[model samples]
Target: MARKASLSGFPEWLPAERVVEQHVLDTLRRTFELHGFANIETRAVETRAQLLRKGEIDKEVYGLSRLSAEDDKNDPNALALHFDLTVPFARYVVENAGHLAFPFRRYQMQKVWRGERPQDGRFREFTQADIDVVGDGTLPFSYDVELALTIADALSALPIGDFCLRVNNRKLAEGFYRGLGLEDPDAVLRAIDKLEKIGDEAVAKILVEEVGATADQAAAALALAKIRTLDTSFVEEVRALGVEHELLDTGLDELSQVIAAASKRAPGKVMADLSIARGLDYYTGTVYETVLVGHESLGSICSGGRYESLASKGKKNYPGVGLSIGVTRLVSRILAEELVTAARSVPSVVYVTLAHDDSWHEAQDVASALRERGIACEVASSAEKFGKQIKYADRRGIPFVWFTHDDGTHEVKDIRSGEQVSADPASWAPPASDLHNTVA
Candidate 1:
């Protein structure tokens, strides 16, 4: 017999870990809904051409086809797993523009596939939670600030630790680069994006040697990258560089506006960081990347940016700004470090015990009653010793178990506290607060 090969990038977790994932998802969905973002889902597979519209993401696309299909192996046609929710969302907005409300706010949580080497905190298959808002004609500059603030608020609501929402303007970056006489401004932005990874020395080498920046220019750019401020003063600090370029000034103004607006809405949540040059090619205005304060080495757990035009239908233009939380990455690190946990084994509310073969139907009735009240319930598979059944519930982390006695009385056991109380099955209710277990 051959030993089974373990796949490198595909991650699977135990039931306990899955509970944590579910809790995270539930929290996100609730927060998004509370803020009036409608839910939307797009197909997992899209045409290859559509996926490759943005050149940077093309290499990471996981193209797929029928395994048994015999014809046309050389000329692969349209079919690839979605790499992120934003692209498909752009397609969705363009396809369904007429039906949607202007300045549409949407929340989409889904699995995205990427064909990249997996490593710690990086996976080929993972889930993302994306929230975006697109206006019909032209999005207001205010929408830009609101989008960033809302995402920062969402992250702050999570069980995760303090996170810094790093904000930058692509226009600002472009202006600074173009001011420096760089023809391909994206090349310089790409180099700056590596500031966290390659350090100041290596990034300076790339900027000066590879990108043809002057030694003085490289040092100045590195100083800009190192510029970090908690408020809008970052704009003033960058201006001190005295790049002598109109575009850089305009970029500075835009960054200043965004930071001021976000601060008014969510004080101390947003920070101005000149180094946050998100590598995506489509972003034309503001870009966002959030880092956990103590876990800065873990990288950005949430990131997104603004695009000038999401649709190129040869007609109307659709501009939008959005952010996505890497739910899988956040959950993976939290679970690995034991930083968070699920309160219960299952999401069920009550577990009804089958006391004996003759009492099975009564157990079903009890479960059905709870279900009628919107409680999730489960009945034991068969009558077993009370101790054994309680042990089963304990193993599953069931908080409460209901059992019937020979005297025609019913009892509900608070398994965690080991407290049992006699009660009428039809009238008994779990305390409102005890209905759901919460993480400690």
Candidate 2:
């Protein structure tokens, strides 16, 4: 029989890699909770109409129905797996509006599905960590800057390498396109979004051929897209493009304000990048993308933008802004590059060994004592020789091994440093820092 194939886009990791994943998830949960952001989860599926409201993303929606059941055929357009967290979140807020708190601050970390061709760093199934705040009435403009800065701080706290947050505003791009005498401003914005994939020359060609731009005008627009800087210097640089656009100026101002606010809290983390035109129809204000230093080619590991009027059920208007970190991508890159490694396999702080049948119960007692003290411990099951037991613990990456003797004595051994010390099981304690795996 042929070997069962591993699904293309569904990625799985071994025990050690899973340790890294757990660490990342734990860190995010702890940090978000510390900052007072409440956590919530919504179902993975939404109505087809809701998913298709933003027409551009329709290609990635994974529509679902019971394959074996005949009763579901009548509801053809009923359910589809969500492509991103933002849309589902909007639907969630509207459904539970009466029960939620105003200015509701929420953080959701879960798997989102997309029916797209799988590639490096892009998966059909992946995890996204999103943070957003929605108000009962009008959301404060300051929350825009606040959300961006909070996400910046969260990403900065991760063990991954240094990252730069590239921010831009939609109004600025729309204004510039409108000022250029383009009839459809959104068309121009969409063209600019392709700057990373299609080079400037191709984009210029498209602008002239498809969007009806003069050669000089197209060249100037392309030049503006190419202009990027680490700080607010991007403002002065884009202005030099000589494109008389009011929207560009407004965008520049918003970018400046957000950068100023973020810097005040965590200096030198946010930068204005004129090239970051996130290709999404919903983004109406500031946008964000994070790139790891020296690994720019890996593409954006975290991205989101502000959206206005997302909560309209064809009537009510609810605008909100937020960001999401591609946790799977970030962790994958770190592991691929060997940037971080787990210090141990299991969660046990110490493994109590059984030398013989007579000492097995004693070993269990010692492990129990350790567990009572808030330490994780596991007693070896087999009554293996002392040398073999120690080797077993070392092979599993169990850092500290406690060998029990019939005389109520124990020997603690550190596998990594090859150090062993005699101790009394009732009174011994591993240093607080050694209780958990330390990233090296």
Candidate 3:
């Protein structure tokens, strides 16, 4: 069973819960590696200047200072806990530009800290799994499609049942708003981004009153936001609005390429959602937001986009496309709803039982032999009765118990089946499914 955290926004999982989290991390690592993405880890702290380089998140940043240090004496450029992985990665790329290859492909999975209100899906400290492909000066558009497919494949491998990888192009939304005679497309995008939180009526009011959009223009913008399709049909849907701009044409073409490829390749897993404006102005091209089928209220469990100028060094720019998975958020929901279960709490597959006081040495020998054969087993702490030892193993979720007899013979019992058979320590092994703890 899991317990509540004494500290708000900080979660601590029980042993069984931890098993599920570990399995999730391990599975993501495997999938990323299979796609030839090398793993890298950044420091947990970054200078304030570095953290705020991309956006002004001062309120959400936790400043670090020595216990004896006074506020006035602290360095003007003091360090603080990193709130996201992208900023540190950008700084790392620029500092190490000479040593890295062009089109660097890396994946980072580490804890990030944010100073925000504690809520059901929000946490102060959580793990994020990120995969990025960066290039020197120029990054091809195909990478955007590749990232969508990669994320789709990774998520599909998990036990999370169904999901939709919503793809959109910033150019499409901005250009559409401009064609509709809206001066501030960013403000319109911001308003549309809140459509899910605040319903369409509220969004329309914001568009008309705040964004300076006429009623007809607001209606037209809302119509575009309502467009969603699994195929390239969204092109005609957007065109039906009778809006046109050079940028809009470019965005429509770019988005069509992505939806065409992703929809065909990852059928039923990808959709072209025009309302996904991403809220971030830096995303120049494609943006992605992912949601579990039945858990739409949880918002996007994963999100990211292409930033053409995230990092730069002496006039050269590093453009990249990436996505980050909210690991802790997903795991929390899984545990809270019992979406999946762990095969065992512990990794031990066999429990080596003791027959007598002198059997310690024999038990050790058997354990050593089994370990040499790549089996995991633990010897009894004392020469307890066989029943007591078996009970201990059962409590720990161990499947098999091995007993050494006075006649120098060995027998292993499957506790779940009550089947005991003669066996050799050197060769005995459990079924493949029982070899390790699994989460499903």
lDDT of each: 0.82, 0.80, 0.90
* Model 3 spans > 4 angstroms off: 72-76
Q: Write one digit per residue (lDDT tens) for candidate 1, span 153-257.
A: 788778887888999888787787777777778888999999888799999899888999988878877888888777787876777777667777777787788
What's each prediction's TM-score? Answer: 0.93, 0.92, 0.97
Runs off by more than 4 Å, candidate 1: 1-6, 70-76
User: Top TM-score: which candidate number?
Assistant: 3
What does candidate 1 score on TM? Answer: 0.93
Q: Which one wins on lDDT?
A: 3
What is the C-alpha lDDT profile of model 2 across 24-112, one tens digit per residue?
88888888887789999999988887777768777787778788855442354688889888988999999888798778889999999
- List, residue by residue over 1-440, the lDDT tens digit for candidate 3: 35678999999998889998988899899999998899999999998878876566778998888988765424548889999899999999999889999899999999999999988778999999999999999999989988998999899988778999999898998899999899899899999999888889999999999999999999999999899999999999999899999889999999999889987889989999988988766788899999999999888999999999999988999999999999998898888888899988888889998888888998999999988988888999898878899999999999999988889999999999999999988788888898878887
Ranking by TM-score: 3, 1, 2
